[model samples]
Target: MGVQKEKLVQVPRIENGIGLMAGFDIRVIQEFADESLRATSQDDIVEKFRKESRQFGFDYFVALSLCDLADPPEDVVWVDQSPKGWDQIYIKNDFQNVDPYFAAAVKQRLPFVWSDCLDRVQRSKGVAQPTHDMLDEAASFGYGDGISIPMLIPGTHRGCVSLTGERPDLSQGPRHTIHLMAIYLFEACLRINKSALREWKAKEFIALTDREKHTLQLLGSGLNASDISEVLKVSEPTVRYYIKNAKQKLGANNVTHAVAKAMLYGHIEI
Candidate 1:
């Protein structure tokens, strides 16, 4: 059996974001950010994020950095604490394309809660699908309430951190404080990852999202972007996005260059 998640200690809820903004221990937050930024690897960065996030009443969190805009990858560069079963079903169904929160995060440059997105979906005309299904599926895994904080990394990529579980006593202030923390955590993630970046020059390995990996595999099998789009059931633009994003991450000049680097790094066989 999996270990049970710990309940958060109660804190007084203050309105208008005053309590968290004015009273949150900025010192401790800065300290964690400093430590995380100094971390040596991706694993270390995730450990720091998990530890710090839980202190803010987040039961579980998943951090993501989207590398491409046209055809964004789901579940990319993320650290998740959800149950294995939940994740298994998610991957099996390719739900990332339809994940309401992810879709919102990619477009909006703001912080929002899961319910906020759900309501927007409900209020819109000709909505893509049911808002209840999205929230209900999450609740099935014990995630009834949650928040998603999205960030735009200057000159690099867009990232987000999603927290879920038993609703903590978060007021306006506390929520804002956590939002700032996500930025710091993402900075640290990039820092550590940069040092270990799998560049064509260095021949080191870099992390790729599951979608990116699959795309690479398909390309290795002599598939073009159009063919890959049909195979993945995604748009052709998305296939291009995956290819370009992989190319950039591998520090290659083009698709062929990226594939060669991937082979050199043993990420795929051709």
Candidate 2:
């Protein structure tokens, strides 16, 4: 997904004020940011982000460049890693038109949850019933809970990073960590060569066997090991073996990350 062509007001520059930011570990955040900046490829950035973010229980991540609302940039960056079916549902329903988080990202410079922004929007001026209904539908697709962090970078359009899960660590500490991690990760993604990204990912595809690729595709489609075993006509342990091999080959920390990498890079499709 990328920026919409519609023209809007530009986001104002704001400084990150001082605070204890007690909820997150500064050391971990620093390490993650450093690692992200050093990443040579988009895949490497996503891998590092997934490894750190999953610790807080998030299942998906999306970063969008809300390029200078005054004028859509020539090149807009959008990165989405989510569960199966959610993307199709989002696009089919056109949720972006009514999404409050997008507005909040442009106007505010802080991290906020979906409900927080919805409530604020409702209080200022009531939104249509469709907004509520759209969110309800999103929850059914595993975006039951989520947080959005505004990414304010100079000389570029405003950006936002959103993470979703059934129940994620949204406490102050984890929020701080996630906020910093997302900012650096998005910046790193912006610096990569967008056109060459596919070629880089394609190079990795040669390492995955057909069975491993199939296993990841099924995993991305929301099947458990047992279900995949039945469908593949193999034992549960065999399914796990395939997953483990795929993870190692992909340099992923777990099955979910492996599946995300495979799906994001076009190694497999659900």
Candidate 3:
């Protein structure tokens, strides 16, 4: 088996003055497939999405690790392909106090509208941000009027696709159509990622022993070899021996590779 690069489909543009204002930026990043399988480079994939986003009129574009879910300020645009001189302060701070819509979408594995979130705000108060600062920022960026779609692959990771604009009333118009287009685009990207992962796993050969598997499980939870040895009640040398054996068995070049393979094979969870 070899690595396969899944093709992504182009999403249609939404019909509205504001909907047309912000463009669709799509990126699919597969680090495991890229490094292990040597299928596609991260830089090449990012550039492809960047070009698509520009052609579609997206104001910003980014491809990141879905598992990290770090809550950074919105104004601190991690992707430089955005409009400059905007209200960076408010954008950066707005999502700080609220439950990230992207996070919610990923967890639920479904497409969600901003309206669905706002309507359910009362129930989502705890998980969602409820700061006046967020509201003020929303007003500034017109974020209240947008759509969010979650992209998830079974037995894999999750991603989010969001489209925002200044349009306040997206109930029944071009804004809704644009949101639909974005959803289709996100779905295509998700399929591509899924296919790539499957292909990469097929070509990769990594195995682990029972003892090494247990050790890796502990290590994934931020445990050192000494700590793992203490919990397992095994000698430090025994633990090292198991790790070495597992590394050789899995064809891992190092300890980190061994751990990664263990996790991928369900021998360890991260």
Q: Using lDDT as the measure, which candidate wins?
A: 2
Off by over 4 Å in 3: 1-65, 69-97, 123-129, 168-184, 187-270
lDDT of 1 by residue, 130-168 (tens): 444655677777776678888886766678888876764
Candidate 3 structure quality by residue, lDDT tens digits, 1-270? 338565576776765654332322222223322322442443444454444333333434333224433553222212223234333653455453354554466566555666577567557654333544565555564444555555554554555556554443344433444444444444444445556566456345444556778887787787888998999999989888888888877677988887787766656778
- Residue 228, model 1: Cα distance from true site in angstroms: 51
* 2 or 3, greater by TM-score: 2
Candidates sorted on lDDT, descending = 2, 1, 3
Ranking by TM-score: 2, 1, 3
Which regions in candidate 1 have their CA more than 4 angstroms from the true location?
1-23, 67-76, 126-131, 199-201, 204-270
Q: Which of the two candidates, 2 or 3, achieves a greater lDDT against the reference?
A: 2
Clashes of 3: 11
Worst window of 10 by summed lDDT in candidate 1: 67-76
* Local distance difference test scores for all models: 0.72, 0.80, 0.53
Listed in order, each prediction's TM-score against the native is 0.59, 0.60, 0.38
Q: Model 2 over residues 63-162: C-alpha lDDT tens digits?
A: 8787433344545567778778776776777766777887687788889987777777889998888788877887887775778998887866678899
Candidate 1: how many backbone clashes? 2
